[model samples]
Target chain A: MKAFKESILCAGHGGQGIVSMGKLLAYAGMQAGYQVTFFPSYGAEVRGGTAHSMVRIQYPEAIANPVITHPTVAIIMNKPSLDKFLGRIAPGGVLLYDAAAAEKIPEKTGVTIKKIPCTAIALKLKDKRVANMAALGSLSKIKGLFSLQELIQCLPFIFSGKQDLIEKNTEALRQGFNEV
Target chain B: MTPAKKILITGNEACGEGAVTAGCGFYAGYPITPQNELTAYMSKRMDECGRVFIQSESELAAINMVLGASLTGERAMTTSSSPGISLMQEGISYLAGCQLPAVIVNVMRGGPGLGNIAASQADYFQATKGGGHGDYNMVILAPAGVQEMFECTYEAFDIAERYRNPVMILSDGIIGQMMEPIEVRYPQKSVDPDKSPWALRGCKGRESRSIRSLFLKEGALEEWNRDLQRKFRTMEAKEVRYETYKTGGARLIFVAYGTSARICRAVVDKLRQEGVKAGLFRPVSLWPFPYKKLKGLDKGTTVFFDVEMSAGQMLYDVRLAVADDSRVLFHGRMGGGVPEEADIINIAKKAVKRK
Candidate 1:
């Protein structure tokens, strides 16, 4: 009756590629044979200001509703998002934020908070956009629920004609996998 | 093979699979809340499966793109939520006038303009009663879950082709965002008749067929409306699907559809556990409204509870089906707010207690 799925909230700035990362995780779950639903916000509300995506994943015969009210995982790509979404994560849930951008990691309240230098690492690796990938890599390492292979499977879909970008992004993903 | 056992899925994803399974070769849509998932899912899956997926610039372009793709005789689809679907009404009317067989899915949300991205069934009147400006009707399918999403989608394409009309998969935010196990069956062989008589596939292999909805002659528009009504009447016979729950010895029937119906089913189960005889009537095909099946329930029922996401759109039709003294009632949770089972069960208890 109630849609009780584990929801993931990916929030950040526009250029940070938060929407693509949310879609990648959703598609990864769908590829893994899990029931997955991904919803993204649009227009002036989401871009550059307070962008966020809601992803709900569930097992068979479990939940009913899909809109993510209490995200089990909160991936914050910026400080504003970290401040806005720190209270939205479920208690004891995982909070992964970019240590390079996030100023204060919200009191580390009951949830698991990981402050990784995603931007610093991606920039060092010569690809600034791969911070979201680093966040995804960090998520995989922390949760161990989804696989790196699943994330890799979604690369070609995102980078259709730009094979060069795919190769660089794959390397960025690998560096992220190793960092976190 | 009985088309294999159906799996539970969200309504939007089901519609996407429905399009893919029905041989929809082209999908063009702009990202909007409540419907982005269907397009996002199609983005990856459609390409992998050899279908075209284009993220259009605006909702207007998306519908017009679908109209363009439909002209080529390809199974094409486009999707949006409320505001975006509103932008598409002009194109929808054009498609209807041109007799293009395209499936448009609207995963509804709260609206008048730029409304909060939350689940609401306020678009009921828009979808069922003439979303666009025209004396025309689109075959509307309101899927309750993933199974209905897939099955109704295939059937929607069939109806669109059969009647030479556009079909709308009217769903809400909850149905669009929710997730359940959805097992897609192998698509049935295309046995439905073709729409080539009016389709614009460059007019090859036959006389040039003009696909336009413009008829300026006197009484011609009236004739077209009457002809559309005739097609609707025929659709009423072939379409019109609903599900009955615990109607064997019921005093009150809860009439709902889409995700609201799913919630009503849960409430009905709760009431059944408490020994209350509350039944459920969920319509799968919303256009043909299932007035006959609903009228059949009017004979034995004591009351009718019209539970909806909005203030009451479908209730009008429910009233049309039941008798005058049947104690028709309304309970709505509008503007993207989901109703709890406790509230529905309480309504049932109070309805029975009043009697």
Candidate 2:
């Protein structure tokens, strides 16, 4: 096998915290001292429209052009975003979308697709906003690229001492673990 | 230096932190999508750090403010995305002409216009090809994750000082929102603005030096360009950085950078499992592209797939390095759509079967 860098893409609506998920992954890479880059999209209409974020994580010496032309893994929170972006999935990429909100999966392709009820799982934890975090938890377990410990360490900064929010978000993530 | 511990912070926060760590005392910017967090974060922390955080009247004013601060030998920074960045180009070029060192961060999004707030790499040409005017290049650093945001932010400042030139941290929306653990280093080595030979201060002790890119003398302007070229050549040789993924024993190679490379890594793993050989080539530094490093690779006549978010700018460099025809292919998702791993695997398998 060849030595290669790992990249991740998180796409959804403006308020979906799609960019936050990418930030956590990039944070993990940066902590390891690997070269990491994060970029999120912005436009006037994104507030009510679909939005996405891309993160590139690689060795210090092995990165070029901080743009992701193709993604290996995608975590989609909304159906519109899924419909819009599903066609770009690489042959062996992992596609994880929210089944609870999506009416149906985008047919079938060569990619490894997983439809999880992220919002439902977050609902069980008493907050649907953490749905993005739930999806992140599932990604770590299935891909085995990131670990629970890393995600846990990241939670504090994300919630920023909001104990109640942290506790609930953590629960939502754990629920996602079981569901995935 | 050993690797630092990872922390979860948005790309905007990382940029602001990078400035703080880099001894930046002034920050000027306007509110723009995907990048509002940078200035917002600065507003919250700059005062505590005794830094000047200014929300200028416009993007133009913001960049000029940074220019003003940088002239006084203070480490200065500003950030914006696509449209806003476009507005600041004039100031950036002027700063370059004056040989001012300042760091600018661009959290790019889809565009020619308002485009979309979705993460996109459409600005590759703008950053590398000189967005403003004339023959000038900004030291562009593309960060695929949070740590790079922090590290590159600091490095941009360092490079700016070293070359007495404007440096750009060319990033996109995804990087701006990412949160990762980072080992922050407040590097030592401060510049004394008063000591600079050409800074505008009041000329209390010596002959006043006027900073301008324009010289009424015809030959003088040409000489300035020559000097810039010499400096750029030095940068190209000393600053190129890239990563090679599974180039050994592979008949197909996928070249991607930033976030796209992450997916490519997964694609490589899946292809290996399927008994197909595929690899990746990534360039970390944009300006001083790692051309020689790529040219030296032995692909055994493998096919090269240049993937990007734009139509293809980096592909031009790949072509230049390979210096061959019919061996290189292009794959990309324009606007704001990002390709998934399965798409990559399918492409790799097809390439393998074709060979």
TM-score on alpha carbons, each prediction: 0.69, 0.75
Estimate how well candidate 1 is docked, as a DockQ score: 0.12
Off by over 4 Å in 1: A1-180, B1-11, B188-195, B203-205
lDDT scores of the candidates, listed in order: 0.78, 0.78
Q: After superposition, how far is residue A30 of candidate 2 from its true place, in Å?
A: 12
Deviation of model 1 at A12, angstroms: 14
For model 2, give the interface RMSD.
6.3
Give the DockQ (2 decimals) of all models: 0.12, 0.23
lDDT of 2 by residue, B184-211 (tens): 7566445566776657888876887777
Report the lDDT of model 2 for residue B64. 95
